[model samples]
Target: MVKEIERAGLPVVHICTVVPISLTVGANRIVPAIAIPYPLGNPELPREEEKALRRRLVEKALRALETPVDGQHVFED
Candidate 1:
């Protein structure tokens, strides 16, 4: 789906726990999730802490969209 969207000329970021899979699928903009069970949130953390983590993940995704790249790229903290 990310590939199809990018093929349409719109930038896309793939947020997933598996970075290798996203790269193999040809996602140019990639953001790593905390884990598979809780992709955006960590249940072990407090509510506020989980929210902060989610925010960081989204911010990275937005940053990935603005970056220019020739192939797959993964955004890091």
Candidate 2:
């Protein structure tokens, strides 16, 4: 999926909890998520805070798209 898109010349950033899996699968742009169940939002967080966290993660993904890399790169919050 992600690799196929990148192979076609489109940039792809994968947001996933398992960094090792993403790296092993050859994901060029990676963003570490909170967890597998709720990668974007944490139920424990206040609603507004969760929203902010999601936004920050998205911003990191966008930044990852603009970054050039020779291999897998993980962007952390």
Per-residue C-alpha lDDT of model 1 across residues 5-67, encoded as one tens digit per residue: 999999898999999999998898899998999999999999999999999999989988888
TM-score of 2: 0.94
TM-score of 1: 0.94
Q: Which stretches of candidate 2 lie over 4 Å from their true place?
A: none
For candidate 2, list the clashing residue pairs, or say none: none
lDDT of candidate 1? Answer: 0.91
Q: Taking the tens digit of each residue's C-alpha lDDT, what string does model 2 give over 1-77?
A: 88999999999999999989999888999999988999999999999999999999999999999899888889875
Best by lDDT, which number? 2
lDDT of each: 0.91, 0.92
The number of clashing residue pairs in each candidate reads 0, 0
Q: Residue 28 of candidate 2: its Cα lDDT?
A: 91
